[model samples]
Target: MAELKAGVVATLETIRNHFPSHVITTRATATGGAHVIIEDVPLGPPYNQATTWVGFHLSDACPYDDTYPFYVRADLSRIDGAPLRCPPLHSTGQVFPADNSTTDTRDATMVSRRQRDQASFVFESPLSKLIKVLKWMLEQ
Candidate 1:
């Protein structure tokens, strides 16, 4: 097990506090961050499933660093039967792209929503980024 940074721990605490009902798991990284996954996250219109898990890497540089390219259940599709548009990264024997150290058990669709404005990125946290990604996915 790797030690977690204070910022990463704080962000994880916030996530757990907000989504009290969800199952959140973490695998600490050598860099003092963690691989996080929140299961059973509710989905909205346009999505085929009622809920799915969301995963992301909260690096040691958290709070100061933006969490990018989240992961969701790979089989996720639109209810309208259209293409997902976003590229899906299947987690078969391939290691996740972020750190290339951890292997996620679930096959996931990579959601590439990064913080565009460097000025406003200071205001973004892991929890906030996750929420924004979920909202963006639901809207798409």
Candidate 2:
């Protein structure tokens, strides 16, 4: 297995601490980073599901690299039966969170959010991005 970088490990730890009740799983990437999947994350408000799994890749570059897109369960729908405001699943049947990476057939839908300013990643860690995305999802 590839070893996780210090930044990747530290970011994972932060995520775990913030979502103590949620189950966070990780798989080391070839480049010394890791794939993080947080299970049973509350979808709250407008969403139909009470909770869904959110996953993303933390490249070895870590804080220097933006986390970009995130993934949630594929079947996500609005509670009022309206069309989902977020990006829908692509033709590949998998959510593409990055150019060549996907949610690995977990049947997830991608939330294509990119930090407006790439330089801000130093201040906006992965955990913060995840929280922000979750809040945005809940409000949609």
Candidate 3:
């Protein structure tokens, strides 16, 4: 269990280094694994209904066994005024906060949008080659 948590932390740190502009948070899932929320990236169209948001899932055994494991999902849909069960059970688990030091929601939204756009390009471009390097490091 400790090793699994370590891997989760390491993955979060790696993502933070690679995508510094994102608002990253972590939560303990009911399954005893962790879920990393990349808040601010809106789910487009169909899934954008009041209850759904998109993010990724990280586990002890990832990448090698799970290709394209960085899932873009709308699993954050809210229900009955309560958010989906992604929050940490006991306390906040904010790994990174949106850079809205002035408490401006617009600024935070814009930053998140920009980061999402940049990430899209990076993932689509040759920059994705870096994933190989990251995978190798994770293996080590």
lDDT of each: 0.80, 0.78, 0.36
Across 1-140, the per-residue lDDT of candidate 1 in tens digits comes to 67999999999999999999999999898889888889999996788899988888887988788797788877777899987774442232222435667454666677878787877766987888888888888888
Clashes of 2: 0
Number of clashing residue pairs, candidate 1: 0
Comparison by lDDT, 2 against 3, better one:
2
Give the 10-residue window scoring lowest on summed lDDT in candidate 2: 88-97
Residues 1-140 of candidate 2: C-alpha lDDT, one tens digit per residue? 57899998888889899989988888887789887889998776697889999988898999788886788888887779987763442222455344454355477688877887866779888888888888877767
Clashes of each: 0, 0, 3
User: Order of all candidates by TM-score, from best down to worst?
Assistant: 1, 2, 3
Each candidate's TM vs. the true structure? 0.88, 0.87, 0.36
Candidate 3 residue-wise lDDT, 11-116, digit = tens: 5677677667768676554433455555444333332343212234454443222212232322323223553333222112221222222232111111011123
- For model 2, the stretches where C-alpha displacement exceeds 4 angstroms are 86-92, 96-104
Tell me the spans in candidate 1 whose CA falls farther than 4 Å from its real position.
87-98
Colliding residue pairs in candidate 2: none
lDDT of 3 at 119: 32
Q: Let me know the TM-score candidate 3 reaches against the reference structure.
A: 0.36
CA lDDT for candidate 3:
0.36
The 10-residue segment with the lowest total lDDT in model 1: 88-97
